[model samples]
Target: MRITDLNPHGGIGANSLFVELGPFKVLVDAGMSPKHEGNEAIPRLDLIDREPLDLILLTHCHLDHLGAMPVALRNHPNVPLVMTPASRVIAQRMLHNSHNVMVRQREENGVRDYPLYRRQEIEQMTGRIFPLAPDNPRFFSSLDGDTMTLTYHHAGHIPGAAGFTLEYHHRKIFFTGDVLFDDMQTLPGATFPREQVDTLVLETTRGASGRPPGYSRDKEVGQLVQAIRETLEGGGSVLLPTFALGRMQEVFSIIHRSMGQRQLPRVPVFASGLGVDLCDYFDQIARKTKAVDFRRQILKDLKVQRLPHGYKPGQRLPGPAIYVLSSGMMVEHTPSYIAAVNLLGDARNLVAFVGYCDPDTPGGLLQQAAEGEYFLFEVLDKRAMLAARRMRFDLSGHADRDELLAFALDLEPRAVVLTHGDPEARDWFADQLRTARPKMQILDPTPLEPVEV
Candidate 1:
């Protein structure tokens, strides 16, 4: 088997992989980088010009995985896109939203290459996509007339996320896209194959961090509730910066349940426009696919209001409101980032992060800032003191290092390839895997580099 890392910058952004098993050529998860602009943000699809792709498999609809699909489809016009049935609707909606964002950025940020792919192109590609039901083996034939079987497993990271297995020529390979082994408020834990494979392609997102002793999901949830309750009861607003898709829904579910149990004060819960839109989509997903355990009704019952407009930075917002906004990393121009500047100067408010934040992002910088240090918001030309409390919860959507290692070893694969992590994170996994079983082959392929398995 030949596998190449298609992500140009490597690490956690623009994740795409080209794998060849016997005669079958497969492209997994064409993605665009969040930190980059225009064409550079996308995967290096030029490398695959020599050979036409036979098929494309989408593990999930996260922007890093689904954002570049229309671009990839344009490159390989004949390739048929495949994904779990649950990802069908969300993928299209996300692509449309992405196009709108691109159009907006083209004007605001002066990114001339914005709207990389047209909406009509996405519509054309939609007709070619086929949704495969999970946990069932389906046969696909390559150009050379070789047959391969594909099966997908539920990956607990987010709604519609999946880990897939490939069987060809008596060799089996498994690919775990962003995965979470533990369950959350709105999703169940992963249910992957507990069998042997020839190769295991695993995500190393959390390889650098270990779960603290006595750390459990329930305990963390309890602590988060306690913090929010304390802040709200003290006449201070709480802001949770989260991703619009999965993290927003999960946090809402937690908040809703906590309020029902009378653990949280019933204050006005505010959400960004995208968050409110996703609630409807998630509701449809829950009713149609049952892939997630979310109900839009709860959000409505909680009185989740659309975030009010005409608010300027440094102005004190109406007190004791819980604001759930998007752009989890608090990127410039995002609702969360703008709100941060408004809320951070107040000693009474709390800004809590409920998901992973890349070290280079504004969210990470704020987390590392001292309580009294001044932080800069470059784009907005604003500066504020770190007066409000900032806290990070262990509500990540990826699996911990130990759990990932155990899963890789349990597969008993001959070779393992690490993806979706920073250099230090990947190095940690490489060291631990080598120490555990020196005979096993562990390959951390550099960007665009091919490795033979």
Candidate 2:
């Protein structure tokens, strides 16, 4: 088997892999880099010459894993695109939302090549997506008369996220696409097959951070609740800048349960951006799959208020409430960025971050700023005083470093390839794995580089 990393940059975003086994050539994912713009955001598909892929396997509906599916499909229109049922629903909405964003950018930001793929193209691609039930093995015959089988295991990062197993010629290969072993507020952790494989493609998102010292998921949630209660008691609002997909749904579930149990005050909870649509999609998936215990309609039962279309930022809120907005990193022009400007002048208001933020992002800069300091707001081209309370929680969707290492050890694969992590994260995993299994072959290939197994 031969595998190549399609990302132009070796780091996390734009995660795509090309795998060639027997007579079949498969593309694992076609993603876009959130940090880049226009054509630069997409994977290096030019290298593949839009070749006719035997199959395209999508792990989840997250933008970083599924954003560029329409672009890939445009090249290989006949290729069979496969994913979970819930992911199919989510991916369609995500792509449609992304198209709207691109349209707005073209008109507002003066982007020349904004809309990479048209809405009609996205619809065409969506129609070809084939949903595969979890744990069901499907066999196919390759061009060379070789039998190939595929199976999906629940990945547990999001509603329909999955890790896939591919079997061919008496050899098994496993790909752990963005996984989490610990349960989240809305979803249970993943359960992988115990059988060993010859090759393992693993993710290293949190390898550099490792496990938090004396920290657990329950403790993190408790801390968030305490912080919210304190802010609300002080007559201040809380702003949670989260990703519109998995992170948004998870945070909403937590706040809903906390209020029901009276662990948190019954303050009004508001949601905006594409997250609101994603919640609806989550509700649909919950009703269809029963994969999660969504006892009641989350938006209705939790009483989440949707922000109106003409609502202006920094406008006086009715009272102490919780606002969950998108663009987790607080990118320019996003709802969280606008809300932060309005709330930063008030000492009582709090902005809580619940996931990873790159240092170059607006959210990371705000996190680093000290109280009473001035931060330049690039979007508005002005500087503002940092006075709002800031807090970060370890409520990540990725598996802890120790959990990933333990899983790798259990699999005992002949070779391991680490992807979807920064250089420091990959290095940390390499050193730890080398120490644990001295003779094990661990590979971390550069972008566009191919490794044979």
Candidate 3:
């Protein structure tokens, strides 16, 4: 088997991998980088532009893993796309939302090549997605009369995230696509096969930071509740810069349960942007698939007020409430950025981040800024004084470094390839794996570089 990394920056962004297994060629995850814009945001599809692809596998609907799918579908028009039922629903909406964002960027930022794919194109491409039931093995015959079987296991990262296992010529290869071993507020942890495989393709997103001492999901949630309660008691609102997909849902669930248990004050919770629409999709999928133990009317039952479209930044809410907005990193022009400007000047308000933040992003800058420091808001070309309390919780969706290392050692694969992490994260994993399994072969392939197994 031969695998080539299509992501320009190893596995950090635009996570596409070209895998050749005997007579079959497969592409996994065509994504766009959130940190880059225009053509730079997309994977280097040019490397495999001329190669004939047999199939495309999508693990989830997160932008970094499924954003640039239209580009791939446009090139390989006849190739069948495969994903779980929930991902199929989420990807269509996410692609549509992405197109809208790109259009706005073209006009606002004067980006000439923005909106790389049109709405009509996305609609056309989504028609080709084939939903595969979880745990059911599907067989495909290659041109060389080889029978290849594929099975998907729950990944526990998102509603439809999956870790896939490919079997060919009696050899099994497992790909852990953005996995989490611990349960989130809405979904359970991953349920991968315990049996050994010949090869393992693992993601090392959290390898750079080992698990912190005295840290647990419950503890983190309790801390977040305490912070929000303090802010609300002080007559100030709390802004949660949430990712529209999984993180938003998790936060909603957390707040709901906290209020129900009286751990948090019963303040109004407002949700804004595409995340609210995406929640509708989640509600539908949860009812149908039971992938998560969620109420079909959870959003309504929780009494989450949908922020109106015309709501301006810094506009005083009715009372001390929790504002959950999209663009978790607080990218310029996103609601989170706008809300931060309004709330940052208030000492009583609090801004809480529940997920990863790129150091270059507005959220990251805010996290590092002192209380009285001035932060430049690039979109508005203005600077704001920071006074609100800023806090980061250990609400990451990836497995902890030690847990990942233990998982790898248990698998005992002939070879392991680390992907979907920064250089430091990958290096940390490499060193740990070398010490733990002296005989195991660990490889970190560069972009477009193929490694044979």
Candidate 4:
């Protein structure tokens, strides 16, 4: 069996992997680095005909992991795709969003535009998808008279995310798509049967530099509540910029739980477009789970609030309120951006980030904003400004260093290949693993590079 790192091997985004087992070719993911043009990062894409691929296995629906499906499908039209139900739904939306992002990038940057694939191409790709529930194993296809079985296990990074186990050509390979080793504080924790692997493809997104020993989600809730209470008492609004899906719902649930316990101040919480959609999705999930069934009722009772996309400027937020908005990275065009501009005018207001922020994104800028950073604004047909403080609180969805190690150690594979991070992160992670397990082989390859096992 041979494996190729398509995009995420060297960088922080565009996590795609291809596997060649005899006559069959299987693609684990097809995302390209966001910085790449038209999903054309891998040079080999143009060289291969569509007939070689037998199957496509998706780990999740994140744009970085699944965005290139339409592009891959355009070249390999006959291949069948395997993904979880929720992943399929979310992937469709995210890919559509990616098309928009790409188009906007082309128009605004004045570059000649050539999309990887159009909306119709994504639709064609969807027809080839076959949904798989957690822990179920199915035959992918027969290539060279060898049958391949693919099994998906939960990875706990997002809803319907999975780590896959593939069996064919008398070899077993495991892909740790993305993982959070600890019992989930948001989504359900993952479990992988230890005896099922020869090659383990892992991720080192957080690298070996571990996080500081911190409190649980509930404890973090306490800290946020304290911060908000103090800030609200000072008569300022608190703006929380979060992701539209998993991260947003997790934060909303935290607030709801805190409110039920009377630990949070009575403040209005607001959501953006995609954030509201995610909330409804969570409401459905909550209804099915006995432990979280009360959440739906709580949300119904509170009906916290929502900010319309067309919300007018000069609108006042309810006093001492908290607003949860979308586009977690604090990039422009998100509701959080509007909220940030509206609320930042008050020196007393705080913009708190509760998730990961890409350094080039607006949230990252806000996080780095100092005490005197002048935020420009317009007031009554005149120029205005406000000085704001950026406070960051960690509510990360990815596994940290120790969690990554523990997960890999538990899997106990013959070989571990790391992906989904930069060179520093992958190097540190490999070093840590080697120091702990001297005999194990850990590999980190560059993008589009092939590895033989």
Write the residue-wise lDDT of candidate 2 on 201-289 in tens digits.
98999988866589899999999999999999999989999998888888888888888899888888888889887777787788898
Q: Clash totals for all models, in order?
A: 0, 0, 0, 1
Which portions of model 1 show Cα errors greater than 4 Å?
none
User: Tens digits of per-residue lDDT for model 4 on 377-450?
Assistant: 32223222456556777666778777777777876677888888777888887887898878888888766668
Q: Candidates' TM-scores?
A: 0.97, 0.97, 0.97, 0.89
List of clashing residue pairs for candidate 3: none
Candidate 2, position 287, lDDT: 85
Q: Predict model 1's lDDT versus the native.
A: 0.89
CA displacement after TM-score superposition, residue 233 of candidate 3 (Å): 1.7
What local lDDT score does residue 406 receive in model 1, on the 0 to 100 scale?
95
The local distance difference test score of model 4 is 0.71
Q: For each candidate, what is the lDDT?
A: 0.89, 0.86, 0.87, 0.71
* Arranged by lDDT, best first: 1, 3, 2, 4
User: Each model's RMSD to truth, in Å?
Assistant: 1.4, 1.5, 1.4, 3.3
